[model samples]
Target: MNLHHNLTKSRLRAAYLVALLTLAYTLSFIDRQILSLLVEPIKHDLSLSDTEISVLQGLAFAVFMGIGGLPIGRLIDRSRRMSIITAGVAFWSVMTAACGLVKGYTGLLLCRMGVGLGESTLTPAAYSVISDSVSPRRLGLAIGVYSMGVYIGAGLALIIGGAVIARLPVDTMILPLLGEMRPWQVVFVAVGLPGLVVALLMMTVREPMRRHDESFAVKIPLSQVFHYLREHRFAFTSLILCQSFAAMSSYTLNAWAPSFFIRSYGWSAAQTGHAYGITIVVSGMLGVVSGGFLGDHLVAKGFVGGRMSLMGAAMICAIPFAASAPLMANPHAALLMLGVITFLITLAIGTGPTALQELLPNRMRGTVNAMAVLTVNLIGLGLGPTIVALLTDYVFADPLKLRDALAWAVPMMMLVAAIFAGLSLKPYARSRSQRLLTQQPVENA
Candidate 1:
């Protein structure tokens, strides 16, 4: 009875830990993504162009995330992941709230950069911790559950921000020392300050003992990681680039879908937010969990490439629906298409990286994931919004023609993503086998 009681307690603790990590991920995304819903207001207030706005939405936030991820990842590998995550959550939460305090485009941009640097600490640490905490058989689902926070936080940011902005008068409020501020600025403060509470909650989760810790006694250089990648260049490159394009599509939609509806269908931000938020929560949440289960199921069934195979298939299959969602004549039809597209595209977001993470030994996992994230953020977050903006601003020179830009970009990116993911299969399988063979001696020791 005591043994059974202990097991139950252990299981519950594991579940609680995962839930906390999921909450952290959700908050991080809310901070990162709220800017999407505020595009027009921010532009008007700051007197910015489409190109300039794109920089704020994409490059300003992403560059630091990409650059800082490497070192943070290294630190995560070397230090206690839980402490890094706790401090990071607090720091990013403060920076997110500071977004409202900024007066100029440069100030907001600097705040965003801070948010990026702080947020960069999360995934490497969270993924590492979750991997360390969960059993191997359940790792993919653990990751998938964690990934759900992305869409949930993003969805809530839109729903909540749009709802708040729509309700508030189009006027500034005088708040003592803060002086006057727009409704949108208020939303940032509201969304960002709550993360501090979460940082406190993280302290409850004990750091799990590191797995495969033998090699970790000494620090591994970045060059060694680069060398490992060089050896399995085809698999890792194909995996990174493939996911990067899919992320490009994902971020593009996140950044612009609301604007598209407002421009094309005359929908209010609140209206779009309410509807899109539901779709994101229902479809996006289901898709993320489904990806994890599917990846694990495939691997269990003895398919090499585990998660990537199913993920690639979905990407290929999703191309038409994803591209068409933006071009629908009826707003309702467009939304329906968006549901399918979102479901399909997001199916791999959690699983793909988790699959890759499983391929690595624990010591190098953080750095490897950091590199992967750098590619995802630099290529995906860094360029997704900008590409669409470039087309609307220069290629078409009409905001109304945004649908055309989406139609062109989404399909192209997804198709290329599918091809590369498929190409990664044999290489990934071979690499996994080799890694397993290499690890046998250590495990036996």
Candidate 2:
């Protein structure tokens, strides 16, 4: 009876931890994605170019997220993850709201940088905590559940931002003290304020203890982290390449999809929001859940190659649809195509990350993830949208031609990402096999 009761308690604790991580992920994405929805209004109000908007949306945030990840990852490894995450949520929440108060590009940039810094604590801490709390068998599912937060939060942001901006009187609204701010400012406030509630909820959650203690005595130095990468050249290269290209392609679509709809199909913000919100929710939810299920199924069948297979397939299948996105005649057609592409593209994200976690030791996992995110965000998110903007501005040179330019850029990136996904297979499978081998003797004992 005692044993059964203890098992029940353990299961409940695991469920609770998953819920907390999901909430953290949701807030992280809400803060991150709110800027995307406000891009048009912010650009018009600030008289910013596409390149400038890219900097606001991607570069500033990526820089801060990259720089902040290492220290935050270290803290999460040593300190209480719940507290770190709570503080981070609070910090970003406040900064996101502060964005509403900023008038010029300089102020907004600084506010975005702050949002990046605060959000940086999320992935490393949350990933580490989930890995520690959940059993390995369920890691992919936990990651999938967490990944849902991105779609859910992003979808909600678009819906909420669209509704508020559409209904609000942007031309006439004037603040008594600060004068007239755009409707976009109000949208930011609305989206950013809810994070305070999330942060408060986060504060009440308990941090779980680390699972492995044998390696705790010898602190893993940064050099050792690099050395481990140096030792496993193939795995290191595969992880970096896969993450970088995938993130590039993913961010490209996410950053520009709404604008694409408006430009190509003459859709309103509210219409685009509803279409994207519904599509993302349905397809993203399905893809992530299916990816987790597929990964577990493959792994259970003694096919350590599951992660690579799933990722490669997703990228390959997504390419044609993504490439054809701009060519669709109407909004409904474009959305249908985009829905399929998003589902396939997002399918690989969580699986790849969870696979990486399985490869690294617990102590080194956070450090490696930080490094991965640094490369992925800096090169992928930071450069991808910027490159697309530059290409649209320079190469395309016509507003009417911008959709074609985006189409060209995204498909090419997806193809490149697929190649990297293929390249990741051998190393990932080998690493998993080796890890299983290393654990066998201990299991036998």
Using TM-score, give the best candidate's number. 1
Residue 71 local lDDT, model 1 = 88
Candidate 1 wrong stretches, greater than 4 Å? 1-3, 440-445
Q: What is the TM-score of each candidate against the true structure?
A: 0.96, 0.95
Worst 10 residues of 1 by lDDT: 436-445
Enumerate residue pairs that collide in model 2: none
lDDT of 2 by residue, 262-344 (tens): 77777778777777877877787787777877887789888887887888788888888878878878778888998888788
Candidate 1 residue-wise lDDT, 1-445, digit = tens: 9978866776677788889999999999889888888888888888887778888888878899878898889998899888999998999899988999988988898999999999999998888888777777788898999999989988988898889888888989887777888887898898999999999999988887777777657887888888888898888888888888888888888888888888899988899889887887778899899999999888878886977787788888889897788889999999999888888888967678777876787888889989889999998899989999999999999888989998898888888888888998999899888887876332210
